[model samples]
Target chain A: MEIFLQQIINGLVQGSVYALVALGYTMVYGILGLINFAHGEVVMMGAMISLSALTALIGIGLSPLLALPLSLMLAMAGCMALGYGIERIAYRPLRHAPRLAPLITAIGVSIVLQNLAMMIWGRDYHSFPQLFANRAHQIFGAIISDIQLIIVIAALCIMAGLMLLVHRTRLGRAMRAIAENQHAAQLMGVDVNRVISITFMIGSALAAVAGLMVSANYGLAHYYMGFLLGLKAFTAAVLGGIGNLRGAMLGGLLLGLIESLGAGYIGDITGGFMGSQYQDVFAFLVLIAVLVFRPAGLLGERLAERA
Target chain B: MSLRFVGSLLFATLLLAACGKSATDHASNLLTVRIGAAAPLTGPQAHLGKDNENGTRMAIEDANAKGIVIGGKKVHFELVSEDDQADPKTATIVAQKLVDDNVSGVIGHLNSGTTIPAAKIYSDNGIPQISPSATAVAYTHQGFKTAFRVMANDAQQGQALGMYAVKNLGAKKIAVIDDRTAYGQGLADEFIKAATAAGAQIVAHEYTSDKSVDFTAVLTAVKAKQPELLFYGGMDAQGGPMARQIKALALNVKFMMGDGGRTPEFIKLAGDSAQGVYASLPGVPLEKMPGGKDFSRRYEAKFNQPIQLYAPYCYDAVNVMIAAMQKADSADPAKYLPALANISHDGITAKIQFDDKGDLKGGAVTLYQVQQEQWQALETVGAQ
Candidate 1:
């Protein structure tokens, strides 16, 4: 049905964003074995920084065509720095302490970043400027906006680029070495700490891209926009296998499609008692189901089991 | 040592100054009357709260310029503003703090969820509380003598909106969406009741939370139902984005909402997609009201920001309370209570008079349409 197609498109767009953010979660977990909860805050900062950068450039009489890409680069650079700094200041210090210590520190960092953002931006829903003219192309009665198409393509390209970066380079080998065995990787002359920082940088950059695209797609941004998104991405990471890169992408898209279809059909399936407000429940339900059925996730985690 | 002697002398001087200032403060306190203005001044709704505060502040300034004598004293009205953060728990806390501060009256707690709970606290303390923006019917139905509002309740505005959709807009099949807040759900329920009464079929009823960002799945479902008009019951923050999303999904239908969507901010948020949207504001358009133009001009000149919404009503609420105190010839709540109960005055919004239930008597609902991305008032209904 056209309705199903429409839901699929929506799902794909939403899933791409989740997939991009999930890569951040999965990569950090793969390399550092820490969840990096504050990655969501970094995602929010990406949107905020890009918005301000775009505004500043446009205010100085630059054309939006030139300003848009330039602003995005600024966002990427800013998020990379923030990602590196947060890992250095918050996670790195707690690395050798208990795992619980780093986990709690990630949460603490999330709170601090959220408060800082709130103070800087004030608590308001700002309307993000549309980067491109939005027009919908009808495919068999299913509407796909230009922004949605852009997001899907951008997400795919980024994922492909990340795949190459993880599989075809010396850095990729070093990253895999560290994930496989940190002690052996260090013995093999791989700088484990630097590799870990690079992983954080790569993950943060992906989140920044996701944040910018999602904000543009939604046409709005706020201080708390990233919290639910981060949670959903984390669920996606866990669903696909926390330490697996391709699994994060697969899990993100699957979760997105399921949520969209479920939200569209749940009311009819439940006989009109429930509605789209219950859509969030589907994501959690899938999470719990995955955790029970496949404790190691769909694609098994690649990290070695510690004694 | 010399340093210790100088520190003791400074402490003694400060003690003497404190004692002297206390005596002067006690006298000044008798000459000043504080009116508590509680609203969310720091959160997303800060603009609305600041508008409410500015309206109250402007009224107090005007009263002082007039130099009204109350209880044989030329009272200088001071506004004690508190931020409720639009939370019910915070509302009650601020209400208690205001009561403890011994304010002569209270102006606002913006949302209905906050106003209703805070009203009970004000009523318990025998203080008059007037809400400028809260429109839920349950706010006044609680039988709290202290609770009053300057705007029409949800019942009147929602009925007017629903009837307009059926009668004027010719909406046959309508869909309803609510943000599931006290205000949003209450208005949606009232609109559904009236819309069904007016013979409009509600094809779909969807609910979303206040914090939700995406409405694609919900819109896709509603689009299949093929409604002629889509009515949203929520604040502008949600309504504006919903409008944009509706357009993004290419759901072709007339969009409509209650006063929550009838603001300049809504148009700004929705951008070009806001065109053709219908909304009902719970008062006559500002240009048509007796004192609205003057108040708006003064407000814009003073605040440097256009009145977001409800500032006129807030100005009137403050004036109405002051009017009661003037008629009672006393600033004490106990003395002014009877005067407030029977008081009537022509305010910026309307002839301010309350029915026995403390509801605004015959409050008007004005329907507006976004024409060329601007809110153009179309008709005024149900004034009497």
Candidate 2:
């Protein structure tokens, strides 16, 4: 029972990161009807940028506590600019072309971003500085580290904040309008391009925060860190229904919980034939099963009525 | 087809022939023995690769300084270094390039994944290849007479670590985790065998990928088993994080790993959590070995950097190859390989000799513990 509770905590923490990254994928797909494959790269750049900023600020004799938020903001800002630039330079040009063009371009952009990060940071794993005090509180004989608690709380706060932004604000209305009917939204005097860019900015910032939280939680960062995380998040988005906002969150958390629990129990359940080493196989299998069973996704509506 | 074009082409061919003849004659006047050193000079493992390359470079420089006269003419040793990027495919390409460059012998292809594949290329061309760091047991079992390594293989180190954990650490129940790489999986398999043989109950066995950053779920499961010790088979990058996680999870058990996790990098990554972790390093520590002090001083003076893991072994590998050449009285690989098979020397690592399977004859595994943020040697265990 303690083991199960421990897995639940681990799953929730892991799920939060997946949920944050999933928002980026879902938002872009919502507005542009394009799966921004480079969204993962945005997450990587967010971590890398923030790490460099934190390192620089700490090197200049600033306290790590003071440097933490400043580095995070810098990373968020950098990722926003990068997201806006990428959409403008790569996706915007191909918006009217065949859907395949923008999809392929997104992949190309992802590769370019990865290689660029590798060139800047070198292809080595770097230890991320722990910004918070390292401590764990036991809950029902299960341990919850301070970092995990902070990450889960921060993720929930961000999700709530995003929900309010998308549902209550004028920008939210414009975004919803565009997702509903781009031509009609433009006809209704919505600055369609501006709203799309704003959506990307918010999504990119969320990804950046997710990146920071993951790096802080794991205490390691590298160029390829975002690949698998991004892949799993994309799966999460699809499982919840791509282009659906709330569904992404649901999918992310569910995927994380499933992954953690599966990893924890598979060895015992399978009598040691399959273990934590095959943990990733379970996630991929979930993805395939979801795709096969429900092509439209659990929460995804049809193309015309997507919101 | 024009007369001028034909004349120009003929003149160019004559000039090329003349240049080739002069170059060959210049080479004949001063015999140049090329030694190829292939390593991942541009990847995550670049620091270690550079360390290997520097060791090989220092050996070549020392050999040249000694002015050994091979085949009557004064021998000038040239090192042909190539970057394998730690990729097995890139390693083979680098091996082919080194062979095309006509090197007398090769000194690396650092990782086991790279070395095993590159060994076939070197053996196909009858070139002797010595690995300074690759410790996988399968490397020497391929029947490639040319493949040689200076350090103990995973079988030796893993067995030593297992026995030490059970006997010395009093680990009655052991849980194992591996990163599922060729090196990690192979080492873990060896450890399981030895630990079980040593009468330790195997309670839990879990695995993770090399790129994994989290181990909480696995640890929670292992925690339930209430194992006395946790043995990991993987490199420092993953091991360090796993150590951090283990500490975070408050799993009251000792940690043990093989040579891959026995570097300073592991200590740095694990921070305060690295305390009391036991790791096995192949061969004796640098300060305790025969030529270790002289090699360290010279290497520091020459390279302006401390010798990372595997430098001393690399230095000895180059010297051992050179010793074989000297004994054979020829720089030709075919001649020296026979000498290499039987040649014994007191190298910086130990008595350098290969068994029939091209494995180190008396390879030793040194156990270490993290104390005060540094790896301190506990004891040197002889291969069983």
Candidate 3:
């Protein structure tokens, strides 16, 4: 019982990070109809930028608490600009070409971003000074840090804000219209290019927040940290139904829970038999099982009019 | 027309003879000694590989500056590096490539899993190979006469930590966890055996993957057991997060880990949670050990970064190899192998001497603790 509750809490905290990153993947797939493989690198860049900001402020004798939000905002802004720039340079040229063209371009952009990060930050792990240095509050026999709670709450708040924006704002309406039918939305006087750029900006910003939270929780950041996390988030987005906003969130949470529980129970059996090295293989096995059963994802809607 | 063609052929033959003679003379003037460095230069373990490479490179540079002589002929040493990518299969391929390249000697394949497979290839080819950091006991137990190591093996590290926990910390009961790699599992098993032999109760045992971040489930079980100490045998990627999670759970149990989790990166990853954690490393820290100050000054002068855990061992391996070459007075590996086996040279880490199994003779393990973000040397235990 206590073990079960504790695993659930752990899963939820991990799920929040996945959900935040998955939202970015789903949103870009929603608007652009292309998998932004470089989305993970964008998250990495945000973390690096935020880490640099925090390190610099600390070096100059400023309190980390005051520098935290400022660095996060700067990181988000930088990521937004990078997202827009990559879309314009790499994706825009191939917009009229075959669908595979943009996908290849995204991969190229991911490599470029990774190499750039390696050059900027050397090939070493950078430790971020602790953000929630000495703070924790347990609940219901499960230990929870303030940072973990912050991450969960922030993810929910972001999802709610995104929902309200999509359903209420003019830009949100334009985005929805574009998603439904790009040609028709253009004919209806919706600036397709502007909406696409704005979609990328919002998604990139969300990834920045996720990156910050992950680095803060783990207390370490590196050039390659985003690759695996991004991969897991992509799996989540597909599991929840790519291009489905709510489904991405659900998938992220579900994947996290499944992984935590799998590690807890299945890990013991394998550890006792073979050793614990096989614990990582459990997550991919779950992913394969989920995709086999639900190709369109758990919450994905059936296409009313299949193209 | 026939006379003109014969005249042209004669002229071309004369030109070829002139060029061939010049090329032959140039080859005879310089003797090239090729040494291969097989390491994980590009992967998750690249950071450790790069440190080892730096030490190896510095040794080669010093040798070249002094000029190596073999059989009364001056020779230049050439280092050829291949990236194994920290995979055993890739390591075999790289080893075969080095063998094909006909390198006189080889240095590396940092991980034991990779080194074990690669060593077979080197042995089959009659190439002498020395590893600076592969500490698994199986690496030496393979009975390869050509294989040698500069650091103490896992058995030594395990017993050192186990003894420390019992004698110094007075731990009555201890829990253990391993990341399940061959290196991790082997060390954990040795530690458990030693602790149990020393009359400590084995309360709980768990395992985690190298990629796992949340350790709440395992920590909760361990906390329920209420062990006096927790032993983790894994690298920093998993160990750091485990420490943080344990602290978050408020377990308050003293944490001890092996050399794999003793890097500065661990402290960075665990933050405040890393404080007061004890670890068993293979040797004393560079600053505190005798004869290390000069090595430190020289290493810092050459490489800007601080020397990492295995850098001194790597330096010693290179020194021992060079010393053997000088004694043999030949670049032929068959001649140098016997000389290398009988080495007795002082190094930055310690005196270099290998037993019949190619394991270091009289090697020691030192205990360290994280004190205010730095590794402070706690105690040293002689070779088991």
iRMSD for every model: 2.0, 2.2, 2.5
Task: Write candidate 1's Cα lDDT for B22-49 as tens digits.
Answer: 1112223335678889988865566677
Expressed as tens digits, the lDDT of each residue in A55-140 for candidate 3 is 88878888877888889999999999999999899988888899999999998999899879878887677877765555877677
DockQ-superior candidate, 1 or 2: 1
Ranking by lDDT: 1, 2, 3
Two-chain DockQ for model 1: 0.55
- Which wins on DockQ, candidate 2 or candidate 3? 2
Per-residue CA lDDT of candidate 2, range A1-307, in tens?
9889999999999998999899999988988889999998899999999999999999999999899999999999999999999988998888899999999999999989987987898655677876657889999988898888988899888888887877888988888889988999999999988998888888999989998888888787778777878888999999989988788889999899988999999998998888887788898788788878888787765554343
Can you write out model 2's per-residue Cα lDDT over B1-384, one digit (the tens) per residue? 997776565556444432211112232444567889998776456657777888989888988999877666677777889999778899999999988888889998788888999999999999999999899999999999999988999999888998998889999999999888677888999999999999999899998876677888888889999999999988787888889999898899999998888877787678778999999999988788988898899899998877767878888888999899888988888999999999898888788989998889979899999998888999998843
Better of 1 and 3 by TM-score: 3
Off by over 4 Å in 3: A61-63, A96-101, A267-279, A301-307, B1-28, B284-290
Off by over 4 Å in 1: A96-112, A122-124, A177-193, A241-243, A295-300, A304-307, B1-24, B27-34, B42-46, B57-82, B89-104, B329-334
What TM-score does chain B get in every candidate? 0.92, 0.90, 0.89
Clashing pairs in 3: none
- Which sections of candidate 2 miss by over 4 Å? A96-108, A180-189, A301-307, B1-104, B294-307, B322-335
- Please identify which of the two predictions, 1 or 3, would achieve the higher DockQ against the true structure: 1
Ranking, DockQ, top scorer first: 1, 2, 3
Question: Model 1 Cα RMSD, Å?
Answer: 4.8
DockQ of 3: 0.44
Docking class of 3: acceptable
Clashing pairs in 2: none
Q: Cα miss at A93, model 1 (Å)?
A: 3.6
